[model samples]
Target: MDKNILGNNVITQIGILVHDIEKTSQAYADFFGIDKPDWSMTDTADIAQTEYRKQPTQARVKLAFFDMGSLQLELIEPDHNPSTWREYLNEHGEGPHHIAFVINGMKGKVAMMERNQMPLLQKGEYTGGRYAYMDTFNDLKIILELLEND
Candidate 1:
């Protein structure tokens, strides 16, 4: 198998696209015997800077983060916008959407992935961090997310 752009194989998060954040989060919590995940909506100001298919576009999602030991489980509910989460839900239904790796040089790693034929799908910033999703489903059978915490 090919090594990742960062030369590390650690997956920090597994993201799931869902139609309803509350329902899916509860199901995951019950299944894993954990407390309900905390929910947050993407800020409107940040949505303006989001990019989809390499163009600045508007997208919003409701997110729920569940801490599971060393990894995090993220539930995403697309909020009436064209985004990676919505595309996944439309094409594949609700399930695993992406596997994310936290890296140091996020821009360099993202460029490497793009050079390797994994074009960027979407990107946005959040508190203390930013992320980019790559279209690597054909090769890896799942989207790959690159995260950088500042």
Candidate 2:
């Protein structure tokens, strides 16, 4: 009768918001001694079906990822859209955004999180999977992202 909402405690990724992804990614690469990874933009709202605080919105971001052993470090540059990424960037400047976990049963996980008072801030679908951001900062000191690959 008891289970963690994420199903496990393994953090698969750490998402960082940046004003300039290219510069940040390069900095990470140089610091880590790895090649700078290419960045891509998130799909438009039509494709991603992005929702921010229950309203559908055209929010997208430039994204780049660095494979760091078992965890991936993500750099995100938001477009001025009404989205989690943009909001976080505007409010906090450039900094860490969310800690992500790969999980199954997206609906169940989201419901559990909401019941625990951590409401969903945003959600969207990508090519092969979907992601949800939970408002866990007050309790966990950080936002949490649930990634469900299908």
- The local distance difference test score of each candidate is 0.85, 0.93
Write model 1 residue lDDT over 1-150, tens digit each, in one string: 336466688989999889989998899889988889679988774544788887776788899998888998888898777788888899899999999998888788888888888889998888788899999988889999988999
Q: Across residues 1-150, which tens digit of lDDT does each residue of candidate 2 receive?
A: 235778899999999999999899999999989999999999988999999999999888999999998999999999987999999888899999999999999999999899889999999999999999999999899999999999
Candidate 1 lands at a TM-score of 0.92
lDDT of 2 at 144: 98
- TM-score leader: 2
Q: Work out the TM-score per prediction.
A: 0.92, 0.97
Stretches > 4 Å off in candidate 2: 1-3
Model 2: ten consecutive residues of lowest lDDT = 1-10
